[model samples]
Structure formats: C-alpha cells, structure tokens
Target chain A: MEVSARNALKGNVKALVIGAVNAEVTVEVAPGIEIVAVITKSSAERLGLAEGKEVYAVVKASDVMIATD
Target chain B: MEVSARNALKGNVKALVIGAVNAEVTVEVAPGIEIVAVITKSSAERLGLAEGKEVYAVVKASDVMIATD
Candidate 1:
C-alpha cells in the first residue's frame, strides 16, 4: 500500500488531527519538528497514555515522497 | 503531498539501497522498528552523513494508514 507522495510544506513540521476522547491519536512528524504521533483523548485515557508518552511513529521509505513547491 | 499506506512487515526492520559512495540515503522507518528512511549512496556520502547520523525521519500522520491483513 506504499506510494510516493510529497508536501508543499517546508521548515520544521508536525501533524495533529482531532481524535475521539479517550483515544490517543498518532501525530506524525520527525524530530526537530514540533510533532509526530498523537493519541485521541479516549484512546489515550483507555490506554492510560498521555502527552509526552513514548509511541513510535512508523513510516516506510516507500511512503516518503518528494514534491514540487 | 501525502497519502495513507500500510505494511505487512513485522519486527525490527531497516532499509538499504544501492547508492553512490558519496551521497547518503535516508532510510525511512520508526523507532522499535529497525528501518525507515534510506538515502542513495551518492546523497549519503555527498552530504558527508553516515549511519547514526541524526537526521529527522519525517512523515505526516495522514500519510500513515491501517489496513486489513
């Protein structure tokens, strides 16, 4: 399911999406960037996870993409 | 430009591909997982980077996908 894609984004970056309460969302990004993985509130609570919790942000090289600005 | 994708891979992993001796390739992967970003040899060595070099492995959360087995 891997495909190449790109982003118009530049500079340090991170991603966050709204998540259901108690669920943790994985916010994806690289270090030096502000964010990476996030957990929804519900999932976070359910798993007893919280902010600054250590979760792995996984991606394959194939998933990495290059794009034009 | 990013999209969601999935992988069937398990356990720690790392990716390496042929590259020119001068450049460093970014092998993409997550922590706890073995491999991720890979740079071609030309890119890797050209940048004067090597293994254990700290480069951010970047990915947007939207780029990550969960799929059926």
Candidate 2:
C-alpha cells in the first residue's frame, strides 16, 4: 500500500501491549533504535500484528513536532 | 524541556517553507536522512526556527502508525 507519511522505518515488532482501546507497539528499526507506536486495538487486530512480525512505523510530517535543546 | 514523546531525534534545520498558516521544516537527522515536519507558522515563529538551527524532531507514540509490506 502507498502511504503518504514521509517516515516509514522498517522494523520487527519487539513488543505489544493491548489495553481497552489502544495497543502500544514497539518496533526496532535499527540496532538499539526503536520506535514506539500507539494505535487502536481494533487496528491492531486488523493488522494481525504480533511480536517478531516485520512492519513499518509511519509518521506524517504534520504530526511531527520541532523542539529545541 | 522534558518531552513525553519517546522519539526525539536531534538534527539541524535544513530548510523552512512558510505558508499562510503552516510552516514546513526539514530536519537532517543523519547524513542524507531527513525528516520533514509541517507545523503551524505561529509555532515555528515561537520556536525561532531557522535553517542551520539545531532542533529535535518529536513525535508521540499515539501519532505513529504501523504498516505492512
């Protein structure tokens, strides 16, 4: 599928925590570099996500924030 | 400042494109690895963003998405 989000880091699912409404997914894009994502539980089920599965962590440019040190 | 977002990539602003209500900022986190972010012009101004300024590209876990190939 074509995704508009500019960032798409390929990684393997490291962990998953399912709550009432949201599911937190941790993807390790690189060695010791992980991206954590919180998506809806329904979406998690739809994606059939599980630990060790390969996935991409997507983030839109608009949702990104600029911060200073 | 303490940011709750897990991902805070350090980079320098490579470019800035200001629009009527939004500003697009490009941050080069690593050589040839750039992350583009679109934020409100007001926020950009408040942050004093400019090319060559060091900044962190932040994103909340909730705003992240998981995609498969």
Candidate 3:
C-alpha cells in the first residue's frame, strides 16, 4: 500500500499478453496515454490480469532515465 | 534509443533533487498523477533535466508488478 515511489496512476487494464515467463500489461491512465508494464507470468496469473481489470502499474525503479529530442 | 519496454510517459520535469551520485526526478504525467524516477547524477546532467523541461519518463523493467485492492 505504502511505497517510496511517488508516482501512482489509476487506470483500467487495456490488454494482457502472457508469455512463457513474462507478461506485458497495458494500463491506460489517461486518454491516449497508456503505461505498459512487463511482469512475471506467475505474478500476472496471481493478479488475475485481464482486459477491463483495474490495477496499478507499480514502477519502483532506482534508475529512471530521462530523454529529450 | 530503442527499448523493449513499452511504458513511455510524456511529461514535464516538475522537480529535481540532486545528491552525491544520484538525482531524483519528478515528472507530472497527468493532472494529479506524477511519476518519480531516480537516476544517476551524470545522466541527469547529460540529459539537461530541469524544471519545466519536456522529457519522457522511460520505464524499462523486467519485473514490473501489479497491485490491487
């Protein structure tokens, strides 16, 4: 519930693609803006991830790179 | 330039806290949804990251987890 990372987006699951060991989850936080998270297949199944399911794409990384053009 | 991870958030740099070796960057992706990324100091300087700077918060993780209530 409590996390050190300050970013939290509320969105509905748009797609779920499960592979042998990893699963890609797409969460649409805003219109036309979506966040994709790659998690373990076991965790995906444990979370019961599917389209239309509401979930939080928790990203807690120490190395968030910034890019510009 | 090209990454396999799918989450790319378009946001402006809101805040930047620099430390000895790493810097914490805060990006406002939406009205109230902000994401925090911790990156290296050198990388921060290389990217020229500052407040009001436009950038993309790239999250490429092999273990992005899903959370629910």
Consecutive 10-residue window with the lowest summed lDDT within model 3 chain A: A57-66
Q: Considering DockQ, which of the candidate structures 2 and 3 is the better prediction for this target? A: 2
Order of all candidates by TM-score, from best down to worst?
A: 3, 2, 1
Q: Give the candidate order by descending DockQ.
A: 2, 3, 1
Poorly placed runs, candidate 3 (over 4 Å): B61-63
Q: Candidate 1: where are CA atoms >4 Å away?
A: A1-24, A27-58, A65-69, B1-16, B20-32, B67-69
lDDT tens string, model 1, B1-69? 333322222212123345444222333234432334444555444544444444434445444432111
- Provide C-alpha RMSD values for all models, in order: 11.1, 1.9, 1.6
What DockQ results do all the predictions give, each relative to the true complex?
Answer: 0.09, 0.75, 0.73
Top-scoring candidate (lDDT): 2
Candidate 1 TM-score, true structure as reference? 0.34
TM-score of the A chain in candidate 1: the value is 0.34
lDDT of 2 by residue, A1-69 (tens): 687898887889999999999999999877677889999999999999999999999999998999997
- Residue B32 of model 2: what lDDT? 70
Lowest summed lDDT across 10 adjacent residues in model 1 chain A is found at A5-14
The C-alpha local distance difference test score for the whole of candidate 1 amounts to 0.36
Ranking by lDDT: 2, 3, 1
Q: Give the per-residue lDDT digits (tens) of candidate 3, residues B1-69.
A: 677656678889999999999999999877887888989999999989999998988887553557877
Tell me the TM-score of each prediction against the true structure.
0.34, 0.85, 0.90
In candidate 3, the residue pairs with backbone N, CA or C atoms under 3 Å apart (3 or more residues apart, or in different chains) clash, namely: none
Model 2 chain B: lowest-lDDT 10 consecutive positions: B27-36
What RMSD does model 2 have?
A: 1.9
lDDT of 2: 0.91
